[model samples]
Target: MKLWKSRSGVAAWLVASLVFVSACSGSGGGGKASGGAESPPASSAGSASQEKQSQEAAPADPLGKYDPPIEITTVRIVNDTYKYAEGDTIDNNVWTRSIQEKLGITVKNNWVVSGDAPGGQGEQKMNVSIASGDLPDFIPVNSRQLKQLVEADLLMDLTDVYEQYASPFTKEIMNQDGPNALASATFDGKLMAIPNTGSSMDGTFMIWVRSDWLQKLNLPEPKTMDDVFAISEAFTTRDPDGNGKPDTIGISLNKDLYGGYAGLEGFMNGFHAYPRQWIKDESGQLVFGSIQPEMKQALAKLQEMYKKGEIDREFGVKDQGKAAEFAAAGRVGMHFGQMWNPLWPLVDNKKNDGSAQWQSYPLVSVDDKTAQPRVNLAVGTYYAVLKKANNPEALLKIINLFVETGWGESTTPDNYAEHFTKDGVERHKYIPFQAWPARKNLDIHLHLLEAANTGDKSKLNPEEQDNERQISEYLSGKEGAELGWAYERVFGKDGSFKVVDKYVSDNLILPNEFYGAPTPTMVEKDATLQKMELEVFSKIIMGDPIDNFDKFVSDWKKLGGDAITAEVNEWHASK
Candidate 1:
């Protein structure tokens, strides 16, 4: 097979990155950093190197260290999963120290906030900071917040600095997914923020199934919507778990119906419904997906499934984490999720039950029409330099180093262990200024697939090489080898990436039509409408009349959705 070229990202659709910069101008004086934020430098052993950097003049050396060094304060949204080495903190990790040693940059966090999810403490604290008009030198914000910052004129336009300071390899990584990522960061022809480009085309949802259970139940693999529904029924009622009890669940789903895991996007796609997307109608007008007739039909099928005891009655209260527990316990036989999900709840289930064997399949169509899963791989996090920061180019330099260490010619295996990660610890995320090559993971999958076929893995990068080793051990069936099967499921011949290949090769991707900033009407009303839609959908799925969908459609239009559609189309026209 020819190699695939693309990247993927974490649960971008699931993670809410809510930010809003107020009209208040940046105080210019930095905010009070938690823990006084004093120490962010290379170890004293590098003092001579620091002195050497201090003696040199600033140059456009893509990886050049600053003369005399420079300090840039920023805030961070620390994830729950972040674990540091001893004597290290979020602002003083391997990444921070590497920046000090290699770039002569001292990066400190103005304040550390907990959790990166939307409406989490990090989002709330950032909102308060925005309201207080205290921002760090270079701050990361989401698309929603970037739009407001652009309107407030509180951010530096990075067009010139990016063009001048970015290395050729860095530029290649930034635009790896073509111009869409950069275009998303651009406003009024100026690049206001450096987009942390992510995977979109490679990020579509697929149906993950308990393949062993299918074999146990004497069932065929799924090819159409009928087969999917049939499998759900058999898994739910046929004691697929062999417990002689009707306890196995048909499908696993989270309360938030659209995410990388346990979401209904793949299920919705079965009926030609693309929720949370903007698609051009036959009339050539951009239309919202949630309110379409297609969505209602899909919802009706889900409602029917819920009524048939295939779905959990109280799913509205369960988040993805909680929903993952059911799958981990081996009660769930199928799900709709992104490609990375096998490494998560599915792996847990496999580890829990050695007999468990889950696999991903392309989302199938309900009729003669092909299924097209909606995907939004747009850049979510953007690093914007403060309008009054001392060094805007520092952001570019840091990103350059970040990219170089991970993907550029300067990269070595040591770079991955030293600055990017350490023994699976994702220290690369702790860096204040960071961006990823958009197609890195997809490239890994392709490389591994080719290596698996040819048995020649010399050209594989560090990450791909590690995955190859894990897959080898798993296939060897060594002690505790099954744990590595998650990697196998993602990169092996039968892995989820193979399903991704099929979906892309067969041209079944339904890319989001709208990727611009939230239109004015959407800014004001989108959240409320989304809330209403979810509540209505949950109600209908849990025994409420299906006609409620009709009411929801009417109310959505009346409550600013029509206006938002108009604004969206206007932006589309401008594009």
Candidate 2:
């Protein structure tokens, strides 16, 4: 009954029926939770091909039960924080039981890794599987790995299975954000994988500055690139920590440049230099952002800041976690990161130093042109079936059941509690196909904002109701206010969602032009290229010659960069 408009808002109101549309919206720095999800977009029922390769499966049903039942193997990623009730596990839990009981699908895990983050155990195990060609029946992979599998001719073409078997609800949820999710997984117009979609718009970056430091130094907030530098200088030199030892850093950064916290992506965006993004050129051709001439300008600015002792010298060696220690110790004043940053390292600042008040501001441009935050296609995980598997359509049915249980008519209170989460346990994690619409978190933000304004708690669900209570407690200065600071900064008035609205209104969130899976040359050479880029950029920021960037651009092109660009353009042209 509500219509919201934004970058990732529901493009069609018809898809909003009978759904709570809430969960995991904030794409935080690291471990960005499915930019929290709700329902999906409309479904497309037709495809180029639909192959029948089931060993023992009936015609596709939106919630059809399997007669004999089939077992599908998969690998999973879970973090240490995951909690489960007694007698429940990643294998024998409510969701796995539901898949078997409802759909007659026995969900089996070939391997389960502990950490779910990039470069964690999950990815390592997956890489080993890719190398050995030993992937399970139902596969969970990233875009790059998906490309590798497709190139190796290992994945089943779900083109027909998804179209014919996916329920209207499942279809809508998958494509809710846009065609990019499906488009990304399409290989030569074949839907080779199911994109576990997240919201790219939620991953947009902003500057998280220490407002206390700003007020203490009598500095104006950054509206332009100059203001950013001036604030950094003032923070570094003025002893804003009030300890008079010149022990503070103006800006903080991690060893990895693109980290979610203490990252430099926002800083580069200010200069209109979108590193790690493939953006469009004036002629509408796709070009890599790091190689653009504008990148040199951003690098030059960072080099200047480094020379002036405004940036941390150890930043070149510190990771995001290590860089955050400077904030907790109140030695750094400003940095660029995602909206969920307050939950992590920044929250530590509030607890450690009572005067440390941080706020997020839109990234200011170096020039008159607005600096748009660039984010990659937000489909973090892809579920695929091996072409050799007997039950391809079974995956689709399982996915449909998951969707039905979450948002469809089956979404009763008992289903939401027992199957989804009970006693703070993420029961849904045990499900094979975990997905939601990109608009879910934004919807939560809108409803929370409206409730704050009108005292109307009628529209909020149980999850949203609890969130409102936490935010209310934070705002009312109740006990344990520090615990609610993250919620308040995220959901309260003038929260990060308000900023998300502004970016959408201004149309300033620049998404990467290349959303399709990695190209052939990209699969072969992207790793080397990314490493070279990070090292070169780090050296330049650490006072390397500015002209070194030109050399990097030349070298990057020579070393398969040219090939990758041609393949990217080829993919783009074909699209």
Candidate 3:
């Protein structure tokens, strides 16, 4: 099923963003408080220490200071699997509830609409507000739409608010939680939005192959890019499934709609040229990946595969879901995904006998040349906010509570997970840590495993709280195998923990630290230009002639690609 469609219908999409600052000057600081003024109530604690903390920390106020209940008006943006329920207005979602009960803020839904609805009412509502000169106190917008919002000047400046209102905890999160978390949110040295900060963990075009198929085919697991071709060829031609039909495909990938890492073109990562990643060359000049000479070779290989009937013929039009469906039903031999791919449409199918039976593997070294793999990692979706939010420092305050509650050095996993589970609003949809930021640390997993197995989660130090909670939940039979793996690593004294521990100990987790910021070029350019890029890239991967790929490069440059490059570099220089 399609989770959430992109929102659309800005009456004048370009104009809104083009003249945003000029348009939204006086739109802020308006309206009388709606709904009865009432502070969020105290929460239920499943344990004593948690109850003590709740009692001592002031009920339902994570922002540190409990202000008189202020009704915060906000526009809701529905994401995948996160939607508006019937008779369940936006004011009653897990996010709003967390804001009220934890921060003493009352949330009011000023506008509500669905992405799946026709005419893009949800997206249009925000556009209409901008056009009509009525901006809500807060709007949770994705990065894609954030550019438009920035251009339209519909959002609060957040510069003064961030500096003055942000708590030390929130500041630390933006500054210390790896690199680029806040950088992505900041534009021209101003805090535009509170970007989400977890997608950074994702990298590489992870390919999920059938482990059982490998064993059945009597073939060794693939270790290099050449092996990918061999394995795919075997699956397609050698009857790896034993069903005797040549129905199996070597690989299934979607070109259109998906974009970036998981898209069909992402397979090009094995060829060492990430199709969507705009990287600096040896001379520090910005360049598009698809136009690189390396890409020609990659496309040539893909074309050869397509001609061999090893690839799915329907690739050109297939979307992520459709391509993934083929793999899930055992019709495709291999599929590319992020590390968490199996947890989604594929894993969801495990209930059905026809569910995609798959296994995860790291990116194979292709060409026997480049050892480094190229993967795109996104930073944050949209920072959520409560409406009529009086606590400008609310984000910081909640981060503080979560940080302290996570691994404040003396906390234990069992205690933290039990409390977090009891207080958990939205369950992590994919990874165990998706719901909250603090749950991402691997160390926290170690502590939680200790707590869960010993029945004393509180024994874990605060420093290990997040990972510990994850482990505790998993060991306690929570959803997600990754969590279970963490638990086993800790309690079973498994080698995985030792390996991860060493990585952490030596600080071996080296992620790209790009200086990211939205540029006026992006705002100035027409959306069609980028849309064209996605379309052409998709076509090239779906068996479009290798020469057509050359045309795409020229077209991209002519269509604002060069301008965007200059703009990005200019922004980088200014920073």
Winner on TM-score between 2 and 3 is 2
Residue 426's C-alpha lDDT in candidate 1?
A: 54
Quote each prediction's TM-score. Answer: 0.85, 0.84, 0.68
For residue 561, what is the lDDT in candidate 1?
94
lDDT of 2 at 39: 20
Clashing pairs in 1: 6-439, 7-439, 16-118, 54-68, 200-377
What total of clashing residue pairs does each candidate reach? 5, 12, 27
Model 3 lDDT on a 0 to 1 scale? 0.50
- List the candidate 3 regions with Cα displacement exceeding 4 Å: 1-62, 67-69, 79-89, 92-102, 116-120, 142-177, 255-262, 348-357, 368-377, 380-391, 398-544
Instruction: Tell me the lDDT of candidate 1.
Output: 0.74
- When summed lDDT is taken over every stretch of 10 residues in candidate 2, the lowest stretch is 27-36
Q: Compared with the true structure, what per-residue lDDT tens digits does model 2 show for residues 346-423?
A: 777888887788888998998888888887777788998787776666677777666556555435556666776567
Candidate 1 has its poorest 10 consecutive residues by lDDT at: 18-27
Deviation from native of the Cα of residue 319 in model 2, angstroms: 1.1
Candidate 1 C-alpha error for residue 217, in Å: 3.2
Ranking by TM-score: 1, 2, 3
For all candidates in order, the CA lDDT equals: 0.74, 0.74, 0.50
TM-score of 3: 0.68
* Residue-level error in angstroms, candidate 2, position 528: 3.0
